[model samples]
Target: MPDFPFDAETHRRRRERFLQETGGGVAIFCALPELVKSRDTEIRYRPDSDLFYLTGFTEPGTVAVLTPHDEEHGFTLFVRPRNPEREVWDGPRAGPEGARERFGATAAYPIAELDERLKGLLEPADAIFYTLGSDAAMDRRVTELLRGFRLTRPRSGKGPADVRDPSIILDRMRTIKEPGELDQIRASAAIAARAHAAAMRMARPGIGEWELEARVESTFRASGPTAGTAFPTIVGSGTNATVLHYVDNARRTEDGDLVLIDAGAALGLYCSDITRTFPVSGRFTPAQREVYEVVLAAEEAAIAAIKPGAPFTDIHEAARRVLVQGMIDFGLVTGTVDEVIEAKAHQRFFMHQTSHFLGLDVHDVGAYATADGSPVPLEPGMVLTVEPGLYIPAADDVPERFRGIGIRIEDDIIVTPDGHEVITRAVPVNPDEVEALVGTEQAHTETQRHGGEG
Candidate 1:
């Protein structure tokens, strides 16, 4: 939307790299279909990340056919034909003509012609790359096309015989951030950081979780019309924070509550994921501070372990050890840290993994391990999220003061040659800074907005 952060040539280079990696296989990628939100209303459509990565076309009912190194007609597009009738109702489409003129398609045709055109395209290919089973209707159409191709094989004698997922190459390519991709990721992180800070300052007892959600996302949109959310903003408060994916921001936060916000922004199609917990009363209770400090230490340790050549597991291991020790120190568990870790006693308080690859998709795809299930070594340009959390439920087994508390600290990290750089540090993670930040700036901000009256 914001004139994609990269130029057409950049997109072409990516396609070229993809072609080189796939070893000249014929590949087809479809844009994701629009979904019905209600009986008649449709949800906002986002292009399939894979298709958008290669073609930069963001329209439904569109397919890209790529033949490595063929040049003259190597990149072909089949798109929905423009219709004045549909145009007046839905927006204008980039018809086949526009596809060729603007999108660098060597050949373009109506999507209705895909079934007829695909045969010719595949006749010369030995191996075809396409993801199956993603869209049911599309899957049926593709299988039917394959059946037709198989039946017609005698006539062509060179039809595609092997099929594989294009992600075989695409995923590995996406693992390392290109300079432009990192720029977009950093920009998104910057915007999200500001949004988090705004949420922190606006936090106060009696605030609605939905209001904070709005404030964070509005900060994203306020950055630019095209800048937006990476995922639904999560604003879980008090005991709700214990629920890992709690998103129903329907409750009002009471004093002494800790509101956890896990949110991000999508700018130029790249994403940023960040989470921070704040005290509704602007200062954590002693019990809350004790658990918060433990989680913070784990987060800092995990992030410190992110550097080039470190196994991805090191990040989790570093965080996990501290949390296990904390459970022992706080008397939530009885055994030694190693003993508890071996028994997985820490799972009661910390259940999720410490980090995940973060990129175009929030839980972005890139193999975390090699074929034999060994941790992938971190390389420069690889981006990930380092998050450490502790959720203690109000149960008889838990210490009364520490119960019903949850704290998670997260930051986006970029692996550099020397070490890692945290892009989301714009929002303070230090306990003292966090306490000092909460609910302190809102009054000053309001006063300044109303002509700076003393």
Candidate 2:
């Protein structure tokens, strides 16, 4: 079986692009190390996004070397040798043989030979493209190799003269999604949309946050055509929603609380991120709907602003303007929209940026700005997320009804020739649809209790 679903040609194209950007530089990629959760239990292993993106090989104990100009070994793999004994316990491996034949490596060797083999690959290169700080052992090996090469420079007189971060080349490539990558992300978005709808239908007072998390994740697992979550599933309710990055999911939702779910699924390593906030009581209170409307408007406006040639920050600015005005209208801050935005006074309620590059990683790989420090222009094939949120703490200064409320609406978007497509609309983002969907299970249970007579 192939380690990844993508055909070797798909990866070849990406690598070709990377090499073109690097101008035939030597590059090194080390797969992530498997981690131990505790004594003998191992955490589920995932490949580094960059390595997986370039090579479509998702194995640990592997390193890939790219010498772009060397036709014979332009792309080399150093990987774990297949062992029957270990396979019985830890599952199958794509061994070095598979590396070349299955994954399209020009040359392959056992990982044990990397130190001996890598020296030759780096000797004639003028520049090296490698990111440090991923693996300590790999960092040391590369540093020592560079030192040794420096010592031998008088004799050989040829070695890598500069080391550049691969992200400089990779970020640009990843930001613009290829057709295949966009397909994967679209599939991922569909799964996440279904999962969100499932969770929303089941939401009701007295439900545990963890239950919502499980419902959404179970939907991802059962409906996959997916690898797993893009990141940890968040099911924050009430005040917890105000605390960004809250993944505890231990609290029991009370009536009228708003549940903020920020979840995404990984489909063939590409990802979809979506966030939807809905009321727990089956219907949103006037205040909850009012707050949610602001966020929805902001999210919609931001997504609408995504078009070819528009700077990426245009989306942020559009969303920020809406949020700032919403804050002003709500009296959360006392100023005009422009005044509030200029002072960043509304950031207290909406602390995060409105959009981010979305694809392989949740945040994905992309530079927000050009080398000149200006925002990058949006182009066809770019995928991103438009999420706008407001969090009002239960503070004495806040209006009583607005306090303890948090709302965020997010959708995955793809930039197209004319404009953008919002892929995550499979699930409802409109407040009416959200209200109609939330607590459907509870309502159905009630109808059953009454013998189908409402």
Candidate 3:
């Protein structure tokens, strides 16, 4: 019910661009397949993000073909057929008839006829563009079809053509998002920001970390059914926060500890990723404040370098400098910033890059390769997350005051022609602003009404 109608115009334009790049080859893309949870049970189904981005069609068992080579036949779509009996349990699908008219496909066919139909479409084309080896079932089907086509003899016998990577052409187009996509991503980031704020306000001693995850998810769901979390929520407290990919969220919050919340909300298929570390008691202790400020400074520095024409690696290096300097200041290391970075000493507390591209997936895809197939450059319309973290595990080498203190500050940002735009501003990151947002009487009222926090 929360799904929006498929935008025909968008699909048409996307096909046009892909066709132009392929120069008359056939491109094959499949919808994400459903997964099973247990015996006779299935997990919630979400369509593949790439397929959804182009067609806005989230239904299963769909395949799209863009042909730039064969002028006579192009833009073919394959979909499921209507079956009332199955519709009673699942749902009615847009059959071939509806797909051709609604999606601007040159022709449409039932998925059942994929093998029979694909053979003819594959011929006359110079090359086949596909994500080969990605889906073993689809791959096997395609291979079998190709093998059969090769054996069959037409009145004028000919063999099948070659296969190529469609990513080479499509990745270039998907890298720069359109205006509509940017708008959706911005809205998603705002929702995620509010969700992070809600989690901070609800965090408290005596409550399990999972309670904070619930609060974060509840804020997203309250917005709309489509506004559920984009990924698994990470609500880690104390030493657990030191684990970068922590997602269990089962530990209990305790007095004098900081909670690290990494979460996001999905709005209209667009996603936003955000992480904020705040005090569980609504105020940071001296040690917690010290580490949080350092991470915040590095995050700000990383974001400041997000301008057009700047290298994506530049931002990472900038944040690295800040973290290295902080490490020296805290007496965790004994060297200058350059010396520490060269020696790779910063890996002790900071282990990952400052940011990565964020869009449909948390780590969106594109031609990360340079023009010569090396590292790519930053450009406008690219959205990325600037997250800088400092994690100090409990160890003898670490200063006693710095032990078990971990902090990460993250925000979603968009590159502009001149500079960048911070999309997740709704979530306060400042020490004072975060304290104020979580310390209000309204927050306490909600916590009390929830029957002892969770």
Candidate 4:
């Protein structure tokens, strides 16, 4: 058997914490079901983030049940049974016996027995903790089980009365990363940094956008660590850069155009998201440089404000202030910085929030606001992304020099005791540094070609 990234004890501690947080309840988690892509094909299987966080098992059709405060058995797992025929088509399964032996489950059973056995488990629970509206099939099954239990409650005096979403407790626990989780995230950042660097080196005026995407993705996969992309790679160039979340990487790069590549890699299920915009010709034009500098300054301001106990909104405010002031200075807006911000005038260029919780999911779990709907304070072990961008459309209202120029600078940051650390700092974001890096690579490629001819 392959060595898992996390040990069994780590999962045990997580389950214990979940139980304590929920007091005494039966918490159920279902793994992601396989989705069909075509008549006989299926999309690649990726485990659900929440399920994988609590239990490291990645196979489909697996379900985990946690009975807190139960003396006999606190953890039970239902897994696919081992079969030679199925193993021939698909890969091998952990099976019920392997689940008990490898995953530290107190009891294990074949998944075929879930419907029959789950009812008995639900009959004695006072409260149920499950993720609702996730899997429709699983949702129906759970509802039917609860309905049966409720119908029999007249005589047995059992079954849960309260149903709560497990994310309430699970999200909080996941917000604070453990040392192991940090290590995984840091490794992911390192791989993504290298991939971005590769993309920068390969970018040229005549290259197709998909070529750069291929280079970055190949580097990510070749570097190991399960070799998966955190999300679809974004390699937008020129006018395409203005569209946020643009994944159609089919455009060709042109001279004097800026390319924005927002891509990341996953290592041990942790993700690293990064975005860097650089000139396709290896040096930024005067117009591109001006906008790039503003976005970089905004990103820096946001990152500098990240500290323990600081309100989460502080980061966004710092970035917004810088961006609004830049817009005023560039004559993009008429009002003063404060006036523009108050009047919501900056949304024309700088739109999205400066930061988001980053972890297993690119936009990871965790509530941004408190009970009263105020921004939550930062805490140690929390990881986030500091991304600030400026996008100018080619319109009559926009200044001709800055029009059609979109630039964004982003980095992955981790909150620490005294300050914060940028894990994705390997790639150059400074204008001069980026120019030199790309120029050096371009020169090297030309020299190699001449040398080969000689």
Q: Model 2 scores what on Cα lDDT?
A: 0.89
Candidate order, TM-score descending: 4, 2, 1, 3
Q: Candidate 2, which ten residues in sequence have the lowest lDDT sum?
A: 1-10
Q: List model 2 lDDT by residue over 185-280, tens digit each.
A: 899999999999999999989999999999999888786444678899999998999988999999999987899999999877788999999988
Better of 1 and 3 by lDDT: 1
Which regions in candidate 4 have their CA more than 4 angstroms from the true location?
A: 1-3, 452-454
Cα lDDT of model 1 by residue, 139-250, tens digit: 7766776777788888867667667888879998888989889989999999999999999999889999999999999999898766899998889999999988988999
RMSD of 2: 1.7
Report lDDT (Cα) of residue 329, candidate 4.
Answer: 82
Model 2 segments beyond 4 Å from truth?
1-3, 445-454
Model 4: per-residue lDDT, tens digit, 215-263?
8999898977486699999998998999999999999999888999999
369 in model 2: Cα distance from truth in Å? 1.1
Please give the CA lDDT of all the candidate structures. Answer: 0.88, 0.89, 0.81, 0.88
Clashing pairs in 1: none
Pairs of residues at least 3 apart in sequence or in different chains that clash in candidate 3? 24-68, 24-69, 25-69, 370-374
The Cα error of candidate 4 at residue 353, in Å, is 0.7
Using lDDT as the measure, name the better of candidate 3 and candidate 4: 4
Q: What is the TM-score of each candidate against the true structure?
A: 0.96, 0.96, 0.93, 0.97
For model 3, the superposed segments whose C-alpha errors exceed 4 Å read 69-73, 145-160, 371-374, 439-454
Write down the RMSD of all candidates, one decimal each.
2.0, 1.7, 3.2, 1.4
Candidate scoring better on TM-score of 2 and 4: 4
